[model samples]
Target chain A: MKQFQYVRPTEAGLAINALLKDSGAKFVAGGTNLLDLMKRGIEAPERLVDINRLPLKEITKNDQGFNIGALTLNSSLAEHKDIRKDLPLLSQALLAGASAQLRNMATVGGNLLQRTRCPYFYDTSMPCNKRLPGSGCGALKGFNRMHAIFGASEHCIAVNPSDMNVALSALDAIVQLSGPKGKRNIPIQDFHRLPGDRPELDSVIGKNELITGISIPTSALKHVHYLKIRDRSSYAFALVSVAAALDLEGTTIRWASLAMGGVAHKPWRLTEVETFLAGQQISAGLFQEAGTLAMRGAKAYEHNEFKLKLAPLSIGHALSIASGLVKA
Target chain B: MAKEKTSKASRRNFLKQSTLITVAAMAPPVALKAAEEQWDERLASAIENVPLNIEVNGSVHQAKIDPRVTLLDFLREHLQLTGTKKGCDYGQCGACTVHVDGQRINSCLSLAVMNDGRKVTTIEGLADGAELHPMQAAFIKHDGLQCGYCTPGQIMSAVACIREGHADSDEEIREFMSGNICRCGAYPNIVAAIREVKGGSKV
Candidate 1:
């Protein structure tokens, strides 16, 4: 790893200002992903403003719902009684990610900002537009088993590798940010950006801005499920995961929210499917239609053409389990 | 604290001088080597090292080091605690697992300077003087290792798994202890060891 200056700031403004002062500076919360990228020479920051000392590690409940600090470790949030009881889907997705040790070190905000697991991005020898803008996308013509199926452009085809983001999208969580200009809140669906011409920009977060916390509104959707299909049963990234939450009234669905992972540049929210499932009775035929609607415009590459079939099945499976119609 | 820092600084200086002298004595008669050393020293002096005071295995160590030095390297290279093995170093493998503030984390991914005032417990700290920890003894009794390369990480993770109450069953232990990968395929025995420790007593 390249040598760099390290600064631990106790105040959020100071950390933000330090990053603003140097264009090559970055904020290190958990260092789970940043350090790995640094060691591999994929990323080289001149200064690292350590934000671990900042006062941002809190998980509080309000009338609006829950406000989780950005520095809240993934393990703590997953095991919290309130989270497990109220938002089991989020807890399940968190547990399905990485492993015990990684969950201990990874922060909620860091998880939101984790880079794609595209092999082309990691291999500096290859040309990856996401890693180096205008360098060209190697995944488009090379091996791209894990490339995006939606919201992908000609510049890049990498998919976002985050289970937590998928669950957040289904839960309608809001991300709170603090910057030099003050504070703002962005809905979870808009937090991650699609890979367009500027593939280097992963999100709408501006320079000198820091994610302070996340706000999730109270929900009456008690039935929730996170189904992840991976290469292994444990400690592996998802091949195609589904986050499904439904509010059921007798045998009919009152409301529904669905999201997918390992298929797009961001969490693929199924608004059409959610609309189609609402006010409808739960049945195998209905779920099959919802699955078909969920994969309407999904385009798959050569190596990942199996996802075209696998994604719809995962959506149906997740909804069946979430609606209590079938056992997970 | 002041006296301890002073003494450590002096000892560091002595070691630096001795290493330099030994290297010079062993080198061949090459004038270009001396010029290269001067250039290296000039470049080294340009980079500032960050000061860190980390407590590991109940010992407080104060030193100035490169900011890129990870907690795993600091423990194994500087403190000579070789039990914490480095596997894959990218946080994919858990061979460098250690307890930071009573929580199991991958030390390889955590920078040493980030652990300024935190307590770190490595495999060396698990024993009570000469006696082995129950988890350690369990691994030995069950023959839970073949190459023994990932043993320290497995033991550390296993202790944490039981403490976190994730070792209630064989399936639960396997899922929670998935972080530590034993390339030699000692998982069944590793699970048995963890089950014995979990069934026997508190971790």
Candidate 2:
């Protein structure tokens, strides 16, 4: 880890000002991923504006639905009564992530902004376009079992390693930001970006911006499920994970929301599959078709060809669990 | 209240003035030119240490620490509280687990400066004078450790797991305690110990 200046500003405005004043400054909430990156020398920020002192740890509800402060710990959010009762999918997703200790330390906003778990990106010795732009992507041809299968460009093929973001995308969550310009809101689907030519840019957030909170709309899709398949049963990154939410009218599906993780740079929302499943009866055949439609444009790397097969199966399994066709 | 406010204001003023003088004295002409280009980097590298005040266990200590030093190093190296082991030094392994405000966290991934004015309970603070904590006693009774390298972290995480209500069943205990890795394969004994503690069997 490199030496840096630490500033703990009590107000979000002051924190933003500090970040804007220092070009190399970063806003650290939980320091779970940032400190890991720093230890690996993947990131070397000169100034860290600790945003933990800011008043952003509330979890409230209103007509718009739930408003979760950005600094709320993952453990608190996952175990919050309102979240567990109203949004069980998000709770399950949070629980399925890292571990209990990590969940205790990681904040909601920090989890949303976490970097990919690509081995190439962590190794400074390797040529990673995400870590160093213009440097070649080692995962493109090298060992890429964990690379993205969707929304991947020639420059980078890293996948977002967040289970919470997958559930947030399915729940139609909105991210609120505070910066020098003012406050703004971005839908959770648009919060994270695909690996384009500029793989260095992770999200749409400005350099000086600080995430204030996230808002999830009151949803009708009550039957929600988050299923993560990993190498190990726990404490490991997902090979392919799915978040499925369904609204049923009798035997037919009224509405559906679906997203997949560990398959794209961002949570890959299966909108086409959701559209196909609506107005359709819940059955094994329909679930199979939805899974097939979800993987239409997915392209796989050399070592990650198994993901092409595993992704659709996981999607079908998630849909089955969400529709109550199969017990989770 | 007036006295505290005045002292705080004076401290702030003193910090500002001293920082300016140090930057002026240490920064060379070439460094100042580079600082003009990238001020944040130059300004940060110019300073050597940052002020940190934290409460560990029951003791409060104020000191100047390198911003790069992790809480694990601050405990093991500076404070001489080596009970908190550093296994991976990254967030992957939970060998440096500690209780920050009664919640378990990995200290290796947390910077020492980030914990200013926060209460931290490491493995060294788990014992009650000469008496062992219930979890520690259970681990000993069940022979839960082999190499004993990962015991402190495992014990810390186990205590938190029970307190957080995630130790109701064997499977739940296994899932919740997944962060702490014991390479000696004493998992069965460890689970037995946690189950005993969860069942209120202190002996």
lDDT of 1 by residue, A2-73 (tens): 656689999999999999877777899999999999999888776799999899999998778999999999
The count of residue-pair clashes in candidate 1 stands at 0
Off-target runs (Cα >4 Å) in candidate 2 are: B1-47
Q: Please provide, for model 1 over B1-203, each residue's C-alpha lDDT reduced to its tens digit, 9 standing for 90 to 100.
A: 24534543554455456545655665465435655576334344334578889899999999888888899999999899999999999998899999999999999999999999899999999999999999999999999999999999999999999999899999999999999999999999999999988898554
Error of 1 at A256 (Å): 0.3
Model 2 lDDT per residue over B83-175, tens place: 999999988878899999999999998999899999999888999998999999999999999999899999999999999999999999999
Give the RMSD in angstroms, all C-alphas superposed, for model 2: 6.9
Instruction: State the weakest 10-residue window (summed lDDT) of model 1 chain A.
Output: A1-10
Model 2 chain B: lowest-lDDT 10 consecutive positions:
B1-10
Q: What is the DockQ of each candidate?
A: 0.41, 0.40
lDDT of 2 by residue, A1-328 (tens): 7556688899999999998776667888899999999988888776788899899999999988999999999999999999999999999999999989999989999999999999999999999999989899999999999989999999999999999999999999999999899999999999899888989988999878889999999989999899999999999999999999999998799999999999999999988889899999999889988888888988998999999999998999999999999998
